[model samples]
Target chain A: MDIWFFLIQVLNGLQYGLLLFLVASGLTLIFGIMGIINLAHGSFYMLGAYLTFWLLQSVDSLLLAIVLALPISAAVGYLIEALLVRVLYRRDHLDQVLLTYGLILIFNEAQRMLWGGDVHGIKVPAALDWSIPLTDTLSYPVYRMAISAVCAALAVGMYLVIQRTRFGMWIRAGASNRDMVAALGINVNLLFGAVFALGAVLAALSGAIAAPISSIGPGMGDTVLIICFVVVVIGGVGSIKGAFLGALLIGLADTFGKVLAPDFASFSVYAVMAAVLLVKPRGLFA
Target chain B: MTTFIAGTGLHTYYGSSHTLHGIDFAVRRGETVALMGRNGMGKSTLLKSLLGIVNPRQGKVTMNGADVTGADTHAIIRRGIAYVPEGRGMFHNLTVREHLVMSARPGNDGRRDWTYERILETFPRLAERLGSLGTHLSGGEQQMLAVGRALMTNPDLLILDEATEGLAPLIRREIWHVIRSIKETGIASIIVDKNVNVLLGLADRHVILVKGEVVYDGSDLTPESEILKRHIGV
Candidate 1:
């Protein structure tokens, strides 16, 4: 194996992993903080992609499209929280699973109805369209590198927010005991709602960012959602730091497995998850 | 002697099992009210009812002259009530400092009486264990942290359910001392504990529940009185 070729694979893995972190962080937040198992989380990711595609067509700017699409996704999440998810907080996990699964179906059909059953892609913005030559025969896209950088920054931003800010304290407190935080005079319901909306924004932002790199179709979110669950499970359900490590580990494993043995590419990631669970059931960071 | 909290005709049920039966409870400004009852007699339930933790099927709760029946828990807290719930209600993952800082707000009554330094000064044990997580602390330390966290909210009324349920005698005495100092600060408090003698000394008024009804309400009774032996004795 050429060392340069291996380096390229590592870079690819980092990019993929960072994107997975963005999605999985949101999933973990929703599950960890609010105790809601939201299957429709992926729908927001799909919506982000579709909305980006739609918005870019009209605005012709990736940044502008993202700026417009995020708040919309957050609003949608807030509405869902108030109308549907709020009713299920005290309900059983099985009930939440059923309702969110129903949400997945509704969002899937909504995307199909609005955007039709066709594949779509966003053009890479000119600023990040350049590539760095790794070898005479190989070069890496600057956009991919930008994704990794953006994700790293986001990971740091998340850490600072959770560890340093007062809102983050409430979030951590809520994760531990919702009632205790409320008893402290914090509006736990409103906090949970804001968290749910933030999770949606993060998930949608991941999709918007990835639209240029991956194909967006009717079921684009389904595969990513399943993979995100794997990431969250391996990362520990509520820990953002855990999601970062888990995404990178899975990203590299999946990428290298695809390159080395296409037949077992999917199996390798699951194998890693199973092996991790066997050793530490809660997760690596939990 | 302004009324801090008043609940009348409170009837609460936990899934068809009636808990508090038309109980009337009140706490005056700067007064310490002790809620006493054996296990399952709705001692904690009454506290829950007053704070809107459990919605009373029939009741009128007025806090600072505002009707707050079935109000949301955070809303009740925002109205200047802080609760140290049963079992201490500690967050296992948060550190001692995090617990104190998470709920810190200037007193709604325009008094900044309880900053982190004042709390640390009050509970030196907490200052020593500032970085320790809630699960890492001993039972006594957790209780102190609970009270300290409640103080950080600078509440008009503080409620502690099972204020000192399981602790060594020394720690219990320390908690009683803390309560006494809190009383000196003129913050109204509602405490629930089994130590009747300690409460008799500390509380300005005592309300004893027998099977969800207030069987005794008085401040003048001595610890050795017939009411204590007949109703509260095991």
Candidate 2:
């Protein structure tokens, strides 16, 4: 491909990487800390997309829609954690898989019933619709850049919350040694509930924000869910820092490989994942 | 004496195999006790039972005379019982500083005595490794870190299950020195170890278990040496 095409694809890769990091960060944290594999995580992302679309249609104000959708998605995430994930806390992973897989189906059927399985595209409220010129003929969308910027900001926020704050300390301690943390007097069940909810909200936010750029569909979350698992495995099972680096690597590789080598594109991401796994079966940073 | 903590008729099991059998034990406000036994003597099992890590089938555990039997580990910790479990159980990802921060007692109290300065003074080696991860430390240093982490809680009763299980001779000496100092502070501890000499070294009382039953209990170590050889085959 030409230079402009390559540059745009690189930009697209970064944007996609950031979004994946956001979703995978939650997945990794919940799985790492709670030791529960939630297959329904992707549904949060799809719900976010659907919520963004609904807000856009109903609210009419693009900025207002974006602002309102975040909290709504967060609440929905809280509900999912409260209602479903809580029950699977001690059950085997296979049970969690079955229940959450069942949830994915339920969510898809619900979305189909409520919104209809139509591609309801989101309009980039004229304000963010413009593009920055990378070349004479090729341009990168400003909105996508905004997604990257916002995701970076959130990553920083998450780092601060996990590394510096009291809650963050509790979480890391609990994740590492549940018995020790409890013996130190932390109400672990309550903590896990909050963490699961927060993870859900973030996952939904990724889905919502990416709605305009990525098409809205029933199976969107399933594809992202698989990628999130790969991302977490590649980054290290439960490390947020690992998730960030891993997402960027996967995003860049998947994007570039697709554009430059169509034949190898589909398998390149897994190839990178396998290589990372080979060195550290626990992932690069678990 | 402060009725700090006690367990009565504690019994437990692991994967259908019974381990602890109705063992009664207690720690007062400020007393250091040692639990000595050979391999598979249920010392660790008793500690786990007290901490709620191992569920007691038929017993009552109380803190300050308040029933806390079957209470979760978090609640037990909040009630002021810190345990340095077997193997140090440190979060290898966290640095020494991070471990201290994470180990701080959340709702413990107004007593601000065991500050960072004092802990660093007690274990200067850990002070140097404060920036290092848990896995980066030597066995002795990790043991010290575990003690430091437990001390940060300023616990009413600190239970050390095999605190010096595997350490170099010098580090072992340092750990004993640390334990002596901790005892001097008037905080009670239940130390489990195979070293009869160490148990006799700092403990005010001795309890040895054989196949989950307390075969010996008292301030006397008269037959403990003989008991250790026969039971532990030391």
Candidate 3:
């Protein structure tokens, strides 16, 4: 491949990896801390995209639509945790799987009922409509770079919240010992609800931003959900740092695999996961 | 003395096994009560039942004249109670500083008596290793961190279960010294330990359990009392 083509591919891989980090980080947090195997996590991403699409009809700016849609996603998450997920905390993984899988079905039906079974497209905002020229003949879209930038900034913000703040400490402590946290007079249920809502907001933000780049349609979340699980498994359950490196590895493998081995494009991601698991049964960071 | 916490006729079970049966326990303001018994004799069960960690099938747990039976653990704890459970309950991911800082809060009566500085001052050994993870600390240091973390809440009531279960002799003495100082500050405490000799001098009252029942409840028993020798083997 030419130098410009390889550069473009690298940027594409990085951008894809950044977006995956936003989604998988939430998955890892909810799984690691709350111990909830939330298969419906990807549905939140779908909701964000749909909400953004719906909001854009009434609002002129895509940025404004996304800003408004995030909180709505968080409320939905908090309500799900309060009304449904709370019951599954003491239950077994089989029960959690059944409930969350049932949730995926419910979410899919809700999406179909509200948005219908048609694919939709969103226009990149006017401010980011142009492209940066990589060569005299080839150029890269500015919106993709903006998405990468936004996701990177959010990643930093997440690190600060989880590592620097007192709330973050409680989360880490609660993950280790729930009974001790409660005995210390901290409201564990409220903390869990907040963490779930935050996870929803991050997943939704990824979807809302990616909607302009990818075609918004039914079952989009299913593919992303499967890929996210692979990321989590490869990185180690509940480790944010693991999710980050794992997402990048998968993103690059998937991006480059298409060019290197077009026939085994889909198999390449799983191949990497299998190889990683072979060396570290518990995962890279576990 | 007014009652800080009282559990009446507590019957707690684990699966088909009955753990605590018809146990009535109480701790008054500024009083230290040592809960004593052999392993699996329901000493921990009584503490758990009173704190709402386990639901008593038949009991009433009251704090300061308010019935708090079947309440959430955090809700019950927020009523001026702090617990240092068995095994120290350390978070391997959190530093000593994070563990203390995260749990720091004013008491239910809005008294910040045990500030972060006060905790560090009490456990200078902890101050020296503020950045170490809770699990990374020595057994003694972890026990001190557990006690310090509990004190950081500025609770009116403190419960310690096996606070020095596995520790060096010097560390155990240090812990007992801190416990003595904590008692001097007028906070009510419920302690469960194997050290009957130390507890005999420290606790204001002693409640001995035998097979899920309170065999003895009084303060006048001497260290060589038949009750302590018979039930605790100490």
The candidate that wins on TM-score is: 1
**What does fnat come to for each candidate?**
0.95, 0.72, 1.00
The best candidate in terms of DockQ: 3
Q: What's the C-alpha lDDT at position A177 in model 2?
A: 80
**TM-scores, one per candidate:** 0.98, 0.88, 0.97
lDDT per residue as tens, model 3, A207-236? 999999998899988889999999999999
Please list the residue runs of candidate 3 whose C-alpha ends up more than 4 Å from where it truly belongs after superposition: none
> On residues A128-207, what C-alpha lDDT tens digit does candidate 1 reach at each position?
99999978988999999998999889989998998988899999889888988888888888899999999899889999
How well does candidate 2 reproduce the true complex, by DockQ? 0.55
Ranking by lDDT: 3, 1, 2
Model 1: per-residue Cα lDDT at residue B159: 91
User: Which docking category, incorrect, acceptable, medium or high, applies to candidate 2?
Assistant: medium
DockQ of every candidate:
0.87, 0.55, 0.89
lDDT string for model 3 (B1-234, tens) is: 998889998999998899888888889999999999999999888888998889999989999999999999999998898899999899989999999999988887888999889899999999999999999999999999999999988888899999989899999999999999999999999999999899989999999999999999999878778877888886
lDDT of 1 by residue, B5-59 (tens): 8999999999989998899999998899988878899988888888888999998
Q: Return the interface RMSD of the candidates, in order shown, one decimal each.
A: 0.8, 1.4, 0.8
Q: Between which residue pairs do clashes occur in model 3?
A: none
Model 1, chain B only, scores a TM-score of 0.97
Candidate with best lDDT: 3
lDDT of 2 by residue, A94-187 (tens): 9888988998999999999999988777877688999998778778889999999999999999999998987898888778787777766778
